[model samples]
Target: MAMEGESWPRVRAVLAEIFDRDAEDILPETLIMGDLGGESVDLLEIAVRLNADFGIPVDEDAAFLKSLRYLLAESREKGIEPEAALRAAYPHLSAERCATLAREAARPQAAPLLCAADIAAYAAAARK
Candidate 1:
């Protein structure tokens, strides 16, 4: 399994290609839906590409993915803050990232609801 840093470029490349942008523009903090104009279909494509490129499933079946899905579901269900839910579910994520995820998740129009850091985190967690 490649380290998260090692997978960063590959993940960025995939996101760049999916969004028809330059890899340099896909910074770790770049938001998939908010900054990059990504849609649900783009997320599916990104997941497929990430799975192919990293040899790790980025689907609901993956533990990290499942956890995130559950977190989102629980957040929506229980009226808990998304950030709080993410903090509880993904302790592997940095405190900063949990804040970012919570902010994105709280947005009404955010689709994909991911940033480059999320991809790197998923890749790193999947490797473990």
Candidate 2:
């Protein structure tokens, strides 16, 4: 579904849920490494959730993932729309309406790949 308001909140919500943390815990400026405490595997898991939820297949190849940040930066530089870039990468996500998605996200659903401290060893190690 197409997330409206151009709000990255949906992504944040997914991340927070997967991390077993409160939504307020993640600021827009937080880094996955320093602030959120994530690693390559955690990121891969996040990508997986993003794929499964949106029905977009994220190419995990280094060439693909590495170019992700670059694409965002390039999009910003070129004044191109973020959705355009997102669509370019993943065609399955429709331009879904915000009201529709709000209704969808509100329902009780299965959580993503979330783990507590003992289980999320990578997150724990990142704390050091």
Candidate 3:
């Protein structure tokens, strides 16, 4: 289920343009915000560009992991484990990654683990 082929290049190009970084430096594993110095505004631009470039609707919340805190809160309210909630919300991420994200979500100052591959996966799924 890994995102590959066409979507990576297109997503990388979009990230490069938005972050003003070379496309070659924008690896699939590169953290969008942590590594590229991306901000909330950049994420908005990324979502907009992905929709326009691929002709696919990009759910900005899902793509950018914007609802991590909300999902965690909801899970707690519903008596569900944070990891389970994270996995349910982001099935494209590995269970291990989801667990890590769940732990990180507890720390308000922690940057999300979202990466270029995550965005590319969203684009690939949207294409289908």
Candidate 4:
């Protein structure tokens, strides 16, 4: 397994290639969907590329947080706070970021909050 630091540059390169943007523009905090205008198909391509580049299988849903909105809704239905649920579902994210994402998820038409760091974290974890 590569260290997180080592995985970041590869992930950044993959994202830049997929999004047709400069690698310098794909910062850790850059939103994949919101900032890069990524769609669900792009997420699938990212998973495929990461899987090949890292020589590890990348679960699309886990890597890209594909089920985040569903998780949020399920949590609310089960009387769990969305922030806590988000943290449980995505431990790669800081609790504070999870809280912020929870609020974003609650908006009627919020863009997904998945970021470049989240994908890199997932790839690094998969390498383990």
Candidate 5:
């Protein structure tokens, strides 16, 4: 069964339940680690729930797992900061979204970059 529009709500609900919070409080942009009182253990639980609920493969070892800031810094270390690198790394995101992420990733004090939105996006992308 392919994930659909309902996936977002379901994803949010699953996170909410796993974290012992209300579903309404778990918005797409809510940071799982920083804002939701989630710990490292929560990451695995969330990934598991996402896979079981939406059939989305949440590879914790993916490049994006190190946070967008790490990705940007790592890319810069390689040479010639590429504009499409972000988009290429996260194929589920759009060009404009990639630009926004690149900017946010440059922030000095940015919080943990993984959010419910990422999980939702992964679910949507996995449907393809």
Candidate 6:
């Protein structure tokens, strides 16, 4: 909810990255499935990433996670609760887990610290 102007661009970039496409050409009016040729799995990835980054309640179930900007905008405009629809669409990330995560994310970071070893470990782990 606190996302500023940079958030939209971030979301768009994440979506494009998930689809292995160019981010520059992506726009709010772009038809995800039609113009981008993303499939169900692709959508699931996008939903998970969006849910993680945006902290929005995504109903995991529903016919499918289709329509990019239109559905989100409509839900926002109509004050529709998307968590239910998202639950209907894909129930993997349960409401309880979502709530718990939101609470945890709201908490401040424990410390501002980093280590070269940690970065090296992360890089090494990613290669595994």
Give the TM-score of each candidate: 0.70, 0.44, 0.84, 0.86, 0.82, 0.43
Residue 116 miss distance in model 1 (angstroms): 1.3
Top lDDT prediction, candidate number: 3
Q: Candidate 6 on 22-66: residue-level lDDT in tens?
A: 877766445556567766686577657656666554443321333
Candidate 5: C-alpha lDDT: 0.72
Runs in model 5 with CA error above 4 Å?
Answer: 1-4
Ordered list by TM-score, greatest first: 4, 3, 5, 1, 2, 6
State the displacement of the C-alpha of residue 79, model 2, in Å, after optimal TM-score superposition: 23
The lDDT of each candidate is: 0.70, 0.47, 0.86, 0.85, 0.72, 0.45
Show where candidate 2 strays beyond 4 Å: 1-7, 61-128
lDDT of 2 by residue, 1-128 (tens): 22223225656676798777897776644556545677778778876775665455555432122344455457678997655664464332333322222233234652221222112222222223
Model 3 residue 119 distance off true place after TM-score fit, in angstroms: 0.9
**Candidate 3 residue runs with Cα over 4 Å from true position:** 1-3
User: How badly does each model clash, as a count of residue pairs?
Assistant: 0, 1, 0, 0, 0, 13
TM-score of 6: 0.43
Per-residue error at 72 for model 1, in Å? 6.8
lDDT of 4 at 86: 86
Q: Residue 7 deviation, candidate 5, in Å? A: 1.5
lDDT of the structure predicted as candidate 3: 0.86
Q: What TM-score quantifies how close candidate 4 is to the native fold?
A: 0.86
All candidates: CA RMSD (Å): 4.6, 14.1, 2.3, 3.2, 3.8, 15.6
Candidate no. 2 TM-score: 0.44
lDDT of 4 at 101: 80
- Candidate 3 vs candidate 6: the lDDT winner is 3
Query: What is candidate 3's CA lDDT for residue 119?
Result: 89
Ranking by lDDT: 3, 4, 5, 1, 2, 6
Any residue pairs clashing in model 3, and if so which?
none
